[model samples]
Target: MKHLLALIFCVYFSGCLMGQQQAEWGNWKNWGDQEDGTYLNPIIPSDYSDIDCIQVGEDYYAISSTFQFSPGMTLLHSKDLVNWEICSNIIDDLTQISESLNWTRMDRYGRGVWAGTLRHHNGRFYLFFGTPDEGYFMTSAAHPEGPWKPLTPLLAEAGWDDCTAMWDDNGKAYFVGTHFADGYKTYLFKMAEDGKSIDRKSAVLIHSGSGREASKLIKVNGWYYLIFSEHKPGVGRYVMAKRSRKLAGSYKEERQLALPSCEAMEPNQGGIIPGKDNNWYFLTHHGTGDWSGRIVSLLPVTWVDGWPIPGEVLPQNIGAMKWSGKMPFKYTEKLSIKRSDDFDDERLAPQWQWNYQPRKEYFSLTERPGWLRLKAYRPLEADKLLKAGNTLTQRTFRKQDNDVVIKIDISNMKDGQKNGLCHFSSQHSAIGIVKEESACYLEYRKNDNITRGIPIRSQYVWLRTQWGLDSKSHYYYSLDGDNFLSFGEPYQLVWGNYRGDRIGIYCFSDKREDGFVDVDYCHYK
Candidate 1:
């Protein structure tokens, strides 16, 4: 069983990817990767460029780009504006809109659905999103685990998109969306009561919308502040604002609070969630890895000189948020899900999901009394990354530079058979494996480049992905002992299509026949 568990992950890329390299004749485990514990700007992980977040009631929620990956809109929740975790993703499959929409397999490229918006009103949640290359859409569900209604195009046209919305105090609803290209030009309009469709004739272009475009309305003490931006990508776009006496009136420019950390990303329009207590915080992000590594940041909004400013640095409210700031809110040191999978339960954890809508027979270890069996799907091509059919994955939410371990016990893995683990976004994915030949291999693919085939001794293979704020990533392969072989370069753990990397396991086949792989445990440190 141990060998079976190990061998399943030993199969490397179909070809030898361990290109010519100097072999270090030392204890393989000697090449241990450790976290420097250094922190960088845009604290949390994500490249969800066109981002929009909302604080509903006491709980805060957010959504970003899914690009080609169906079951889109990775939803997030947070108590203190800083530390956030995945709550539920809204889509199960793109079956309703365009079933053939997956560019993650093309150049394994191009953006899918870019910027997204999350809005809550009258006890229901609303999500507005758009594929920059496709068109704009709006979908909703009572809860995040959406039976989400079919997708509907919000605007008559859809180029590059950024959509923002808010429910005004006088029982009125408004939507502000923008089109992107050389520069962003925005228009404000009223939405139908249902919040799914908008009044196109009511749309009005309010800004030059240069750089990036976005706007959200939040009023306080009778003053209505229109938050918008002219965020030019490189030169440090400002999170400027305009104030109007009324919700949809002519306003004036405010001020710039936070700038891009590294000179690449400037401040763009972040969603403003007005708390029940009347205070507001801005949910936004900045660039990290060469326009690729962008992450989410949060801040309290403070008004000085008649303009809004992000109260503290970035994510000044992560985990241990202050109630008033003078007296610290004392609680536990820190909190995060360490590990789970007592598959002893009847249903799968909320965090686990197949690539798209999955069926009962597709996978279920219960039949094997704790063995995970995933039917074979397809030979993964560059164009159908997640669409390769049966990819079961989860988001890597922890911020620590940790290692992930998965236990697999598969029987006959031969004749175009495949069973492996993966860290996937839209375009980037990787795995460590034991193929039918009994040889162990570590395989990884990002965009057009695939680096793989570093050998391991035993089939009991442990493949790990590690990174920190610096976001430099390394893959390590280990056998019986904790000793591991470090393969691949220090590839930055940047965003792929429109989201961050999600790790899980897969069983694919060209025949489209379902194959099964049983997994025991998965430990993330």
Candidate 2:
């Protein structure tokens, strides 16, 4: 009896400890939820750019662009707009769109999947996104968490972006998009009911201007509203909207909806979603590019004389940004974007993505239990880290400071193989092991510059990168799990390829595909 009682106590204690650890891990990053009936701005301080959101019966879903990354189009779910969690990724294999996105080529950089839309219609979830080189493509699912149908190309012509779809009351489907090939002309095209094709002859010019794009269409209270973004010559990007009683013509002259707040990046290019209590909110990203990418912010929408004004209404009818406000709903669930991974699960975390569509055979989670095994292979371009295959990555969230640490087992490393952790945009920096001629040496690489450190014989090492508000990154490594020693010169993280910095684990061979590394764990905070 005493033995059983002691066993019960031990199990209960272990469970509690695990629960505490998970709770702690979830709160490691700067989450917007204050847990006290109000939330903060930059709701998600990561690279979830070019966002579009919709609300469906008390639940909110938002989709963001994932350019040149495998598992494109990240889908997020939330009870309130401020707090969100990764629910699904719409595109699992980007190579379906084009082979140029494949791991071997590494061709597309800033140009793969651009702005798109997400809408729920008639018990189906539909997504439409575009590539500058490959035109527009879409996919649908019966449920948001889905076995999504394969992508179907809707338009084969290029130089189009920011595509959105709407089904009218009479069930006539319409598609709206911007044609950058012709100086930012926004057009409305009648789409077939099946959504597989568009009648090019039915195109109608809705709005046209210099630097006009990110168009969204919605019907509210017998009015058709078209919201979009335009770049001012000296002022940066701003949000604008026009409304009409008809979908095809006679939209009023566009009015300014929102602009940049004091010292903040321009607020532009997102969705306007209605709240549960007839209130409304605008989900937008800061348009000016920075090292943190385009971080998202939530603004309160106030309808003034039939115009849904986002944020605080100021002179000239533009809305001022709000940094914090009452929760859209009074729910208490604290959600966060998943970051750390233990490599114990059979599948990769939804937050993780390869730099491009990776070669499936080059990576495995089951090869070594409780570890992620990445088989080394030669990059398409020798000594080019960005051209390497199977580099697993996730967005770097902005905070006062952020740190990422990973434990790597290098016992299987071969000569000419490099295995380590990295943070990169166009320029990247990494600290890892370089196996050369029967000796293992610590190496720090910043772009094409390589700094070789002392020789080491350790079979396992812990690599870390620390970056802060300045967006400068410093790399360190440790033979033991603790006592890390800095190795590389500080690298300034940049905004490139339409993406912010990403932290990743990489393994690549400069010569042959005969080496591998096992990453036991990754902790980000």
Candidate 3:
């Protein structure tokens, strides 16, 4: 209540642009990075981890890891580092990586695309990402919002993750990647002139340290800086920097640049981007977090004696700082990922992502003029919703309560088909309606346990899931749009498979792939 009043006061007295306020993607009051000079810790208060940002002219393009989500490699663009909008997704189809993504087993939950590095070189946008089990891959496009050329597998061997690409002043390309096979070691590999293939014979040890990964190569003022992350005793995940005059050998010993932060510990594992004014900033993710997962934070970077310090360094080399400081660039506009979906448009919003590569024929927006029609298909197995394909999902929030409402039409549902909205994670819960032999019933699934057979005569009903910041979830249902009655026990939202909790709309069958559900709209507030 107080927060709402405070939000109202700030909206009124602070002269926040009404258009910008109306375009907020998530909770209004918790939006980070204010227009004032000083910005907050989390520039984005959601799970946008394994982030890498590159400055291309005055525009900034950033990419985040999307493990199994189809249209992977979430690309975000910003005029200022503080404000960003979803620009594009580099990988339009997960099947391009492996057909296993669409397998009946429905694999590749946390094993698909990992941390990626984005860079602009010679008027082309290049992205390099790795799979923990499938080695490294590269893709390129003339524009950041890309019809990115298909993923070219650079290295087919396993045990590599978090790779970055760069080209030296001599026109020779090099790739910096981490190999976990022989402990945590960062490797430097020479790349082909085109940057698609790496010379296997040119692999060299760049840096090796405990928990060291997220390797990136940055050149500044004739000195080459190799940035990485490490986990130390009692300090958590921290950033490390090593520098040398040359690109390959004779690098300096690692220096601790930043330490675990109180705002969200383990403020680690992100690349650095410089402002147009030449001011540098470190883009990091808080490794320690709740159901919001690893949220992103942008910290001020200062170069002291050739080392890039993330945030402010404390006395006695204790830890790095996490405080709101002066913005490196002017905050002129506000942007966010589009969230709400009325299903009235020809396209789905950027906030919508499939659990994996969705079968194109299983879902449609054009089939039903003004609704999202999800054709019900049998689960890969008996009754596992996680294995159910075409589950459209969006990230949930923390630090504030989130209300999700979805109106599902069951008029076309068939027996043995269950279609409704759910909160999904390692442990998931759903308040959905099921069509049985002769009638429809409301059902609830908590974890693996489920309760069904609550009769509902309506052909259309509204389902609601209230996700509290404290991780509690309340499920409700309504025949009419007005009043909502709590149906199930409070389910605790959880984190699993390297992802935060996601509120998703799913339609699957236990019998046959012969049913469908028309969703009028899904509203999140």
The numbered model that scores best in lDDT is 2
Error of 1 at 28 (Å): 28
- What TM-score does prediction 3 earn? 0.91
Model 1 residue runs over 4 Å out of place are: 1-51, 102-110, 144-148, 181-183, 252-269, 274-280, 288-292, 311-361, 365-371, 380-387, 395-400, 423-429, 434-461, 467-495, 500-504, 510-514
For every model shown, what is its TM-score relative to the native structure? Answer: 0.74, 0.93, 0.91
Clashing pairs in 3: none
Candidate 1: worst-modelled 10 consecutive residues by lDDT? 24-33
Error of 1 at 389 (Å): 3.4
Q: Each candidate: what lDDT? A: 0.55, 0.84, 0.79
Give the Cα error of residue 37 in candidate 3, in Å: 2.7
- Name the top TM-score candidate: 2
* Residue-level lDDT for 377 in candidate 3: 86
TM-score of 2: 0.93
Is 1 or 3 the stronger prediction by lDDT? 3
